[model samples]
Target: MKFIGEFIMLFGIWLLLTWSLAPAQVIAGVVVTLLVTGLAGDIFVFKASRAFNPVRIFWMIVYIPYFLWYVVLANLDVAYRVIHPDLPIRPGIVKIQTSLNTDMAKTFLANSITLTPGTLTVDIKENELYIHWIYVHGKDVKEWSEAIAGRFEPILRRIFE
Candidate 1:
């Protein structure tokens, strides 16, 4: 069941990317997706039922736009800093703890942080993620955690946990 789910998801992605209904293209996508699913299906999704849950799917769809908005905002902020006369940046690494229990949830949080223009995820230890920020606005760990990972955590929790 897990293998089938992963294969379907990956093949859907391949179809979307290629945007073709040709028999050859579909056959190749099936072959590639099958090989990938055979090799990594176990690591991809632990629970097939949860992976296909309606609420989680809804949250995942919602998360795309929410994440994109942050990406745009971060890009603008980074651009402004780069083009500014003084280049005002307070670069520092701060640790932010996550309440997300599952590894998938944590991975999503880390990737989201890294994808943002001004913030990069340096390391993740247990429940805490160390992030390097272009400008460290938050004073303490709590503030930093709330400022950096807070926005994405709830949405990810709903989708992955």
Candidate 2:
């Protein structure tokens, strides 16, 4: 089941990237996607049922816009900082613990943080994620975690866990 799900996903990506219905392209896509899926399907997808869940699917769809909004906000913030050197940049690495359990959820969180312009994911140790921020606003670990991961956590929990 995992293999099938992974194959479908990889093939879908291949189609989206190639954007062609030529027989040769599709055959090549199938061959390549099958090979990749066979090699990494287990690591890529832990559970086929969870991957196909309707509620999770809906949240995943919703997460795209929410994530994009943050990306836009971060870009603006970074642009402002670049334009004005007078603004203080309290750059530092801060550790925040996540309540999310699954490795996939943790990975999504890390990627989301890294995608934001003002922050980058440095390391993830178990439940704790170390993030390098352009400006650390939160006073403590709890505040930092809430400030960084708070918005995404509940939605990711619904989607990935």
Candidate 3:
């Protein structure tokens, strides 16, 4: 049952990405989807146990604006330095702790931190996240991690495991 559902979801995504409901297109989708399912063979999986949870996942959709706002703020901060002063940049590497228990949540947090300007996730050592911040505003590693964990963890926990 799970296998068929996975294949169907993949097929639907393929159709949406390819944008063709024609017979040949549908056939191609099924073949590709089936091939992926066969290859995955239960290895590739959703962390969340439930098949679906739209209500709980609703917060993720609502979080898009906030995410975008943060991204924009980060970009503006980067742009200001590029355009003004003598490029005041205080480069530093800090170990940030992660509260994300699952791989899915941690991956999302790492990717989110990297995507946000002025900061890049250099490495992840178990529960600790190593980040390279262009400017160490507070000179506090814990504070940076708190900032990340506070803003992103809740949303990821709701969406993923």
Candidate 4:
């Protein structure tokens, strides 16, 4: 059951990425998905979960709009900094901690930070994530984590953890 769920998710992602309805493309996707599911399906799907809850999927769907909005804002911010006469940027690596327990939640957080325009995830050790910020906001770890991860963390916790 779990394998089936994971395969569906994986194959669905492959389909989205390829956007091909051809028979060969779908057959290849199914073959690849089967191979992955046989090798490491446990790592992909939530442990002990055969299927995702509809409510959680709904929350994730809701989050997409917010995430996209931030991406747009971040692009504008990066553009402004690049075009500014003084080039006001203070880039540095900062460490922060998260209370998110699940591996999926942490991965999502790291990816979200990396997707944002001015931030890139450098490393993650246990619950701590090191991020390279284009503008170092402050040195306070808790405050810094809140500034960077706060937006998505709470929603992720509700969705995945």
Per-model C-alpha lDDT, please? 0.90, 0.90, 0.79, 0.88
Judge candidate 4 at residue 131 and give its lDDT. 94
User: Which candidate ranks first by TM-score, i.e. highest?
Assistant: 2
Model with the higher TM-score, candidate 2 or 4 = 2
TM-score for candidate 4: 0.84
Residue clash pairs of candidate 3: none
Stretches of candidate 3 exceeding 4 Å from the true structure: 41-43, 47-51
Question: Model 1 reaches what TM-score against the true structure?
Answer: 0.89
Judge candidate 3 against the unseen true structure and give its global Cα lDDT, from 0 to 1: 0.79
lDDT at position 89, candidate 2:
82
* Count of clashes, each model: 0, 0, 0, 0
Ten residues in sequence with the least summed lDDT for candidate 2 = 39-48
TM-score of candidate 2 on Cα atoms, chains taken together: 0.91
lDDT of 1 by residue, 89-126 (tens): 99989888889999888988999998886899999999
The clash number for model 1 is 0
* Cα lDDT of model 4 by residue, 1-161, tens digit: 78877777889999999999999999999999999999997666464351367777888988899899999999999999999999999999999999999888899899999888699999999999999999998769998998999889889987787
With candidate 3 superimposed using the best TM-score fit, by how many Å does residue 5's alpha carbon deviate from the native?
Answer: 4.0
Ranking by TM-score: 2, 1, 3, 4
Total clashes, candidate 4? 0
Give residue 49's lDDT in candidate 1 (0 to 100).
Answer: 90
